[model samples]
Target: MGVPRAFPHLKMRQRPVNISNFKGSTIALDVMGYVVKGHYRMMKTSGLADDNTLPDSTPGVISSVEDIVRTIVAAGCVVYLVADGKKLPKKAKEHAARAKKRENDLVMAESCFQLGLKKEAKKYLARSTVISPATVDSLKGIAAKFPGKCFYFGALFEADSQLGYLAQNNLCDLVISHDSDMLLFGCPKVLFTMNTKGWGFYYEAVDIPTALGWKKYSYEKFLKMMILAKCDYVKNIAGIGIARAQKIIESSPDLSITSILKTVTTLFPDSGIPDDYATEFDEAYFTYLYSAIVDPMKMESTRISPPPLDLTEEYLSFAGYVHSREQTLDIVLGNIYLDSGRPSRNVTDPSNLDELFPPECFFNSMYEHKKEVLEFDVDGWEGPSPNEDDDEDDERPKKFDCVECDKTFDCLSRLLYQTVTHTNLKAFSCHLCKRTFGYRQTLELHMRIHGGVRKSKCDICGLTFTRQDILTNHMAAHNEARPFQCDQCPKTFKTNSCLHQHKEVHLQVRRYQCENCDLSFKRIRELESHKSTVHYKARPFKCDKCEKDFTRKDYLEQHCLAIHTSERPFVCEICNKTFNDSAGLRKHAAVHSEAKPFRCDICPNMTYKRSDHLTRHMKDTHPAKLEEFMAKKKKAKRPPATSTEEPKKKKPLESTSKANIKIHKLSPQLAKLVGQSMMSQIDIVNKINDIVEEKQLYDPNNHLYAFGDQDLVNVLGVLRFKIANVFNLLNRHLE
Candidate 1:
């Protein structure tokens, strides 16, 4: 259930105490453990009876429950019974595994029975014990008989968490449960194995960390240790038992699972750790720390019934067990109360239990409170009582004021909301704009404005809006959508502002007029922008690098790229040259290609690379033909106004340019041979062969021209110089 053998190792120093020691104290009872123990006791005495005859076990079970309750009540202590709820979500796999184990145990028990090992068979059969639904119903009926004494949580809640909550909140002086996990749940004090005899060991929450020799280990560290030891959710690491786990946890610099795993792998090289061990550990850790449980306030709301001395017939009948009145009374009243020779009191009897055993008596009985108080002398000293100003304070109305905004509210909650809204204590903030909002929903709405995220789409026109309300308003535009009508005209518009603008056209009104110029606009923002840029020459947007400014922020960004930055993002595949923009690269590509799609209509042979070049040629050569060509171009480009058409697509760039041909430079000797030949200026290669043959300078073995003398070297030098000049001219034309 928790860390195995963790209780004995972490138990506080305890001594034997009698039932009278806990008089007038409030104790929380773990009802599930007592019920299970009682059932087991009944089964042992009745030789493990079948389901049909199990009702006979109810008296013994009821006897056990009453024994524990009466012992605590006889000592003048209050008992609040807490029962476990339905199976926990985190324990689902464990529950299934347990069921499988029970099945195997049943098989083993049957095998043992056939082997004539009756003792071994019974042990195996006991291992398969399960609490039936009928037993649970019977227990619930018994609890109903004593109203306000029991609490049942939701189906998926844990009883230990409720017990811890009650103890931690001071609702109970100590929790009485067999579960050691209550220590991890932060119960300040817990009494374990508390039975009718009142002989049990109690552990204080502080004793755990102290016994573990932890300097800074918190509740979380303790939980991590429990998880490492293989709790209900997590599997144990092979070769890493409780002792090794404690060492690993204590020696680890970081308590995180990742850090712990790293240290474990280093320490135990032979132990093979699973790859998904960290993930499993995380799941277990979160389940233990954050799984839902019964609220402490809800536990407090449950009624507490005074201890019952006599048994009720309704409870006896519901139990379905045939027992005599004397036997039922004995079962309801434990040996501690009955054997003490005290007469049982009826429910109708007048008695003040609080007066009989006060809380001060219990405090005095504790061993820790055995020391006597030392008296100090005080001469002529008087102090005001805590309730001295209560009369004056009660007359005034309660008010809460925000410290930051200096605003007063009727309630503390309102003041807290206003304070957080005004202060920078907001949870949500925008990274781009550096703006903050008090609520996440408000921040989400603001993000939509920045991102232009229009998720709500209109079915009619496919227009979208960031908000549902705006989308709903836009839906009206599909059919009889235009409700705002102009009085002067029959035309209608979707919005009142649109109708007002249309009416202005009839009235010939220009609401926005420039102060410096005669320019007028329907909107004031446009007029202000024009006046600032053209009249005042004001540039609000400035570049960070060059200190240059522009009226528009977009223009300032463009200026930064074009002037300050030498970033050539566009490349010409034809020439392998880079340009600042795609437009520059397109114009540069025209030099390498011969295809000119734009042609003159007047002259069939005359063509231009670009449409603008064709227009320029037409205007320069023949002005009359230019207008006709432009009219034809416009007619060809025009589409029907009713058609929702897309813009013309750009031509895909060629991967490899056909005009890219490599040229080689002539060697000095080859240049010399060409210069000496008569056809050197025309057919250079043929001229070089003739010159080599005439001069007898051709090597027959290598088929190469050889320079024989100093005269040849001088002639070759002059030829090389003239060849270089000619090559330069050819290179210029290629470029």
Candidate 2:
């Protein structure tokens, strides 16, 4: 739902990392989703929902937040727990849709209960999750336990935008969330799908270019594509998905949003695009680019980016309205509840709140009104009311504009008919599969696939499509009439647009240049691979099957195919020799050629078709010289280490101060050893130094613990006393 399938589409950039990797760094966590999930789990397990309202799941929500925050803090990270404060006006449509869904789920749950399906009833009941103000207040109590280690922030609207702001401004080192909207909000680093077992998928914004196979990285183009792919704020053009949106963006001139939209409209002329699509696109763009976030340091509300001087007031409100400083502080501090809009000024003073109202009273009355509204409206709910002017305007012969899409019509009847295309409510449903569609035409189109009634059939592939244009596009694939060919490379395309896109590769400026050799690549990964393989000779990618390592991931994959896999997909045309990969087959084909391009340097008479054969000839024919040759090759593989730059000299140990010894609480046994002979002191000091240097017991950078052999002989006495104490405890336990 968030840019649809964005998480899976970015699988290439996702890295599985342990939670401990962020040790000693600040992380901002979005806890609202976990709140809903925890409530569902509790409702499902306990099966104690009251009237299917889940009034008892509040404790489970609190426990969930506590568990998640404590788990992260235990891993040595300082967590900034961020929760949603209020709903933004831009998301009102989405909120209504969700409310309708919950209402429908309630009806389903009630029906299941009547039919003696208790388990199914509970399952449907659990999906009706609502995060309330009481949940946010409970987070304050959880944060209090850890003090500086865990700080809570109640966002003005969305927690993801707040988390993104924290990450972008370096207020936090990482953001822990599964929301793809964080990517659109410009969070530099996000850890998604993390579990309590300390593992998660990680992605960085800089990896987008390499992961998506783009010649260059452009956040503007990426955001545009994600918007066109569909988001919470706007509906996407029909028939266009992530792949097609990317193609459209890449092909557009000047790489502007307007041009991209124009391209989309051209590609999908009858896709029912909104008449005011340009405005919606801008709103979605600004919503991601300049979301309102509370500054953790300043404790005040502010937008992520400064608004343009020429920007309108309406666009500015997309970030959220600015309230008084006191109101903003109260909201950010979790004094105001998110959903009910109730003020709990005494929340910070728990002693007063408990005296005024019992703790159970505060929670038990949390959502009683919400439950009543939902239960009463389940059957009689008729959705939101139509505009009051609809009936009056129908009598006049005036221009009518559909409110959802802004499409104008001469008559109100025509406008009402077209408005159905954009509304979420569905009246017409498929009889065969019981699927609903907003329009009858759409339902009929869906039925064609189920009925196998495709009208347009292909002559060559024997495949059929519902529409002529789709069939025409499919026919082009089998046409094989590539009249347009690339002059730079041995490639051809059926269309001029495809050929033009291919030609761009030749002209693409390689902006990412290697610092070591100045070799350029169109993408950052290529530059990274060149640096790792050609300059550093670092083999970081390793094969788990054979323990063979390579400098690049693709090289490791190829090695796995050639060694571990039995499937041979590529075959040599001349000798019929099969290989697991195309590169191996190509190498094998060279053996059948008359030309021998590779000649051994040590043995000039020996010639071979492959470089590896020449290397083998040199090794077998001249073993002694081959050793020297390998040494030279290895030396050339990596840049020579600079000898002029001297290694960092270790600082001489300072004398241990009395204050440190007192703070560390030296044992009486250590004091007894300190009063012994100088010879014994020196012996103990040397042994202690050996242990310290070998095991790295003390921080090398800590001047207070840096000890000199002559001045810190008592250190060994202290260590011996501690070791003796441990053994004594073990001995006592054994008895």
The total of clashing pairs for model 2 equals: 0
Query: Could you say which candidate leads in TM-score?
Result: 2
lDDT of 1 at 307: 15
> Which pairs clash inside model 2?
none
lDDT of 2 by residue, 430-465 (tens): 543345676546675776555545657788889978
- lDDT score of residue 231 within candidate 2: 82
- Give TM per candidate: 0.40, 0.48
Q: Which stretches of candidate 2 lie over 4 Å from their true place?
A: 12-14, 48-55, 114-116, 349-735
CA error at residue 485 for candidate 2, angstroms: 50
> By TM-score, how accurate is candidate 1?
0.40
lDDT values, one for every candidate: 0.55, 0.63
Error of 1 at 226 (Å): 1.7
